[model samples]
Target: MSIPLLKYSLSTQNQRVDGYEVSPGEEQPRAYNTDNLPSSVEMDEVIWAAYRQIFSEHQILSSTSDSNLESQLRFNQIRIKDFIRGLVLSESFRKLNYDVNNNYRFVEICVQRILGRDVYNEREKLAWSVVIASKGLESFINMLLDSDEYEENFGDSIVPYQRRRIIAQRSKGEMPFNLKTPRYGADFKEKFGMPQFIWQGPVRQFRPQEQRPKAGDPALFLGMVNDLATV
Candidate 1:
C-alpha cells in the first residue's frame, strides 16, 4: 500500500509576510512567462531561462539539454509546467540529481528548485521523503508542481524562480539554491573519490642558499696554478 504524505509545520522563515523591497543597486529577478513570448527569439530565451532555473546555473550543457522537451515547448504542445516536469523526469536529470543524491537530499533539492525555497525543516524533508518512498519520484514531483504554493507563484505559464530573494532588513538575501546545494552530494563525492583538499601538506617556506666561496676553500685555484707551472 502507498503511504500518504505526512503533515509538517510551515516555518515563518519561508513565509512571505513582508512586502518585497529592492535596494538601489540590487538587480531584480526577471520573470519569464509564456504569456508575453511573441517571437522565436523570445521563445528561445524563455526555454533557456527554464533550463537555467531547473538545472541550476552551469549544470545545463548542450549535451544535457532536452531537445524533445524543447521541441514540444516550441510547438506549443506543452505548457511551461509540463516542460519543467519533463526536465525533472528526464534521464539527464535522473543521472545528475537523483542517482547521485539520496531520497532525503533529493527531496531537499527538488523543494528548492521547484518550490523556489528551502524545505521548512527536517520534518518537512522527512514528510516528502515518505512520498518519494511510497509513490516514487514522479508522484513526489507532481505533488510539488500541483501544490497551491507553486500555482500562486509560477502558475503554468511562468518559469519558477527564487521567491522573495531580497528582504528589506537583511544586507544580503539568502544564497542562491544552486550554490547552497551542490549538484553532487557528499556521498557521491566520497564514492567517486573526489579529493576535498587539493593540497594536504603544510606549505614549505623558501630559503636562499649561500653562493659565495669561503677563504678556506681557496686552495682550488693553487692546484690549477701548480698544473700550469708544471706544464
Candidate 2:
C-alpha cells in the first residue's frame, strides 16, 4: 500500500541537497525513490524540455535594440538557478504536505523557468530566456539525468521481505511481467503477456515498477505515463 505520506523529510549525510550531510539544525535531505513516487528521471525530462524551448527560442545576444541582452541573460540564469535552489535548498518544499508540495513546486519552477516575466529588467529577462533556450540550462537540466536501482526503489517494496499478500494487492496494476525501457512495455498485452501503458494521457493509470522510456521517444510509452507536454 502507498504510505499516507502526509509530509516528506529530506535528510542527507551532507549539507548539500544534491547528496550531502551537514550539522544539526542545518537540513537533512531524505533520499527519494522513483518507483511509487515522482522520479528524478521524470523531473529531468521535464526540465530538459522546458530548457530546450526557452534557450533555443530566446537568447541574450540575439536582440539588436536598446535592451541589454547580456544582463537579461545573467538574470535569467539566476532565476533558473534560484528556482532550482528553492526545491533543493528549502527546509520543506511546501507548508501542507511535503510530497504534494514538492511535486507541485517542481512543476511550477520548470514552467516559470521556461517562460520568463515581462517586467523583468531587460538583461534579467533575456538572460533567463537564453539559458533555458540553450546550454545554460544544461547543468540544471541534467540534475536528475541518471539514477541507479537504489535511487529507483523509493524505500518501499521488499524483495526478500516476502509480503505475498501485499504483492498480490499491488500486482493488480503491475504490467504482469518484467520489461526494459523503450520497447519493453510494447509486448505487455500479447495474449497472456503483460499490458503496456505508453507515456500518453493520465499518468495515474500507470502503476509502480513501470519503466520510463527514453525521453527521446516518450510517445512510445505514453500509455504508461500521461502529460506529454511535461516530457
Candidate 3:
C-alpha cells in the first residue's frame, strides 16, 4: 500500500492559500456593509442592482423592467429580503429554477441564494430539506427567508449576500464555505457504491499538514522524533 506522504490544498479558480486570488480555503468576510449603501442617482438603478445581486444566476433581473423594479421597491418601501423572497418563490423561479433540481439540490440552492452562505452541514441541509419534503416548497422557502439566522446576518435593512465566515476549530480552522459543503452530490451517491437518498459527504479527514498537534498530544513529540530520525 502506498503511504500518502503529501497532501495538497487543491486550490483552484479564485481560491488560494497565500495569494491575492479570492479562492475557497480562505474565510472571506463581507466585502461591504449595508450601513452606508451607495447613493444612486436613479431609484430604479438601485432597486435593479439589489434584484440582480439576490438572483444573480437567472436572467430574470434584467428581464424585469426598470419601471416595475423601481415601482415595486418603492411600493414595498425597500423591505429587501421580503422583496427577494417574492421573486424567488414566484412561478418564474419555480419553473425555471426549482423544477429540475431534486429536494437536496433545491434546498442547498435556496439556502445559498437566501441565506448567503452554505448550509452549516448536511444536518442543516436535511433540516430544511425535510421541511420541503413534508410541509412543501412554499413552507421550506419561507422558513429560510424568515429564519433567525437570516435576521441576525442580513437584518431587514439589507439585501442578502454571502455571510462572512470565522475560523471553525472543529473544522481545523477551515472556512465555513468549505466546511459547509455537502458530503456527497448526486454523482457521488450513484457512482460510488452508496445507496440513494443518503448523502455521504462528510467533513474531510484532515491530513497532517492541514492540522496541528496540541500541546499534550503524544503525536506532536512523535512527529518531531520522526523528523529527527529522517535527519
Candidate 4:
C-alpha cells in the first residue's frame, strides 16, 4: 500500500518536509499558513470564479433591463463573501491555519458539476459540505463562482450569478461550524482521505517570497466582484 506521507504547511511557501519533496520551487510546493490559508490567494479566487461560472450556468444570477432573475444570487454572494473573509480572519486560520483538504476536495467536485462533468460522488458530497463547515456562507458563494470548470461551461457573466447563488445556498442551510470546542481544528483526513497536520509555529525561520502584481491589483475580495461587474 502507498503510504500518504503527510505534508505539513501544505498551503504556504515553506511547507513542511515529508519523506519526499513535494514539487520543485513554489510551483507545486505544499501550502501551509500559521493562518491556515491556502497558498496563492489566486487559487482561492479560482474557487470563487468557479462559483460564479456555475451560478451563471444555472441562470441564477441573470437579470433583464427591467427585472432581476427569479433566483436571488446577489444576496447569496454578499453573505458568502463576508463569511469567507470572516473565516480567513478567524483564530483558526490565523493562529494555526491548517490545510483545508476536505474543503478543497469538495470544491473540486462542485466545480466538476458546474462543468457538467460527472456529478459528485458520495465522498465528494461530503467534501462539498465540509467546505461549508470550514468557511461557512462565504465558501458556498466563492466555490460556486471560482471553479475553472464553471468558466469552461459558462463563459463570461459569472460574477452576477455568483452573488445570487450564495443567497440561495444560505437559505438552504449553509453556515459556520458552531461548536463548544471552538478551538479544535476541523478534520481534513476523516472527511476526505487527506493527511492531517497540526499547525505548529512558522516553519522554522523561513521567510516567504514576495510577489507583486504588475498592472492594477489582481483584484481581491469584493474588489474582484466589482471587477467582474465592470466586465
Candidate 5:
C-alpha cells in the first residue's frame, strides 16, 4: 500500500503574493512557451530553455538532449509540462540526480527545480520523502507536476523558473537554485573517494619570471651555501 503524503507548513522566507515584479535595472526571467514560439529556430530556443530550467544546463549539446522527447515537443505531440516530465524521468536525470542523492536531498532538489521554490523546512523534506519511499520516483514527480502550485505558476505550455526571486526590501534576492544546491551530495563524492584539499602551509609571495633569481645568481649560490652550512 502507498503511504499518504505527510503534512508540512510553508514558511514565509521566500513567499510572495506576486511573481511578476522586476526591479528597474534587474533583468527578468525569459519565459519560453510552445504557444508563443512560431518557427523552428524559436522552437529550438524553447528546447534550450527547457533544458536550462530543468537540467541546469548552460550550453546543452545536440547529443545530450533527449532526441525522442525533443521530437515529441517539436511536433506538438506533448505539452511543455509533459516535456519536463520526460526530462525528469529520463535516465540522465536518474544518473545525475536521483542515483546520487538520498530521498530527503532528492526531494529538496525536485521542490526547487520542478516546483520553483525551496522546500519550506525539514518537515517538508520529510513529508515528500515519505512519498518517494512509498510511492516511488515517477509517482512523486507526477504529484509535483500536477500540484496546484505548479499549474498556477507554469501550467502546460510554459517552462518552470525560479519564482519570487526579488524580495520587496532586500538588497539581493534569493540565490539561484542551481548555485545553492550542488549537483551531487557530499556523500556521493565520499563514496567515489574524491580528493579533499586543505592548505596547511604558510602563505608565500610569488614573483614574476623576470624578477626571479637566475640559474647562477649570487643570491642562489648564497642560499645554497646557507643550506649547506645549516646541514
Candidate 6:
C-alpha cells in the first residue's frame, strides 16, 4: 500500500544531498551524478532511435555529438531505457518536459516517454508519484526505467518506444503521449517542475551513518552493536 504523503523532506547525515553527512544546521555542498562515462556507438541507428523516442521533448545540445552519446552508452553498458532516463532527467529535458507540470501530470508524461504508454491505473500512478515525492525526480525516473515491466518490454539493447495502445474491447482512445495539448495554460505556464505536494514527504526512516568500518577493523570483527558502543 502506498503511504499518503502530504509533503517531502530532504534529510541526510551529511549536508550533501548526493550522499554525505555533516553536522545538522550546517549547509552542505551538493553532489552531482551527471558524469560523462565512456560509452560506444557500434549500433548507432539503434541508439539514435532510442534517444529520439525517449528524449523526444529535448533538443540535442550543440556540444553533444552523436559519437559522444554512443560512447556513453557502450562504455557504461547502459540499457536503452536507462539512456532515455538520463536524457529525460538531463537539465535540457527538465526545462522542457518538467516545466509547467505538477506531480500527477509529470508522472503521466514521464510514463508516456519511458514506458511508451499511459499508466495502467491509479495505483500505478500513486506508486510512481510517491517515489518522486520521496526520492526526487531522478530516483523516480530510475524506478520506471529499471522496472521489470520495462526490462520485459525493451530489454537492455532495444530502445524504448510506445507500448501496445490497443487492447481490443478492453481499452480505447489514442495514446496520451501523442496528444497535441500544451503542458498548461497561460496561468500555469510559469510553473516549473512538479508541485510541492509530491516532493516534500519526510523520509520513512533515517540512517544517518552509512559508512562501514574497514574489513579487518576491530569494529568489523566485533559486529554492529559492539562497534557503536565503542564509538
**Distance (Å) between predicted and true CA of 151, model 3?**
1.1
Better of 1 and 2 by lDDT: 1
In order, candidate lDDTs are 0.80, 0.30, 0.57, 0.36, 0.79, 0.57
Q: List model 1 lDDT by residue over 142-199, tens digit each.
A: 9999999999989999988766665422545567765565467777788798889678
Instruction: Name the candidate, 2 or 3, with the larger TM-score value.
Output: 3
Give the TM-score comparing model 3 with the true structure, all chains together: 0.52
Model 3 Cα shift for residue 201 (angstroms): 31
Clash-forming residue pairs, model 3: 14-22, 14-23, 15-23, 183-201, 184-201
Task: Tell me the tens digit of each residue's lDDT in model 6 across 48-145.
Answer: 56555655534445433345555677666665556666677777667656676667777877877676666556666676778787788887887777
**All predictions: root-mean-square deviation over Cα?**
10.7, 23.8, 16.0, 25.9, 6.2, 22.2
Ranking by lDDT: 1, 5, 3, 6, 4, 2
What's the CA error at residue 189 for candidate 3, in Å? 12
- lDDT by residue (102-204, candidate 3, tens digit) is 6777777677667766545566666666677677788777777777868876777576655544432333454333233333456545666676565669867
What lDDT does candidate 2 reach at residue 89? 29
After the best TM-score superposition of candidate 1, give how far the Cα of residue 97 lies from its true spot, in angstroms: 0.4
In order of appearance, the predictions have TM-scores of: 0.76, 0.15, 0.52, 0.23, 0.76, 0.52
Q: Which residue segments of model 1 deviate by more than 4 Å?
A: 22-26, 168-174, 187-231
Q: List residue ranges in candidate 2 displaced over 4 A.
A: 1-37, 57-115, 119-231
> By TM-score, how accurate is candidate 4?
0.23
**Using lDDT as the measure, which candidate wins?**
1
Across 1-231, the per-residue lDDT of candidate 4 in tens digits comes to: 422222222131111113243535422212211122234564345344433333223222223111121122232333333333333333433232223344454344333333333223445445556656755635564555555544453444322222122232344453211111212234554656556768988766654545533466554355778879998
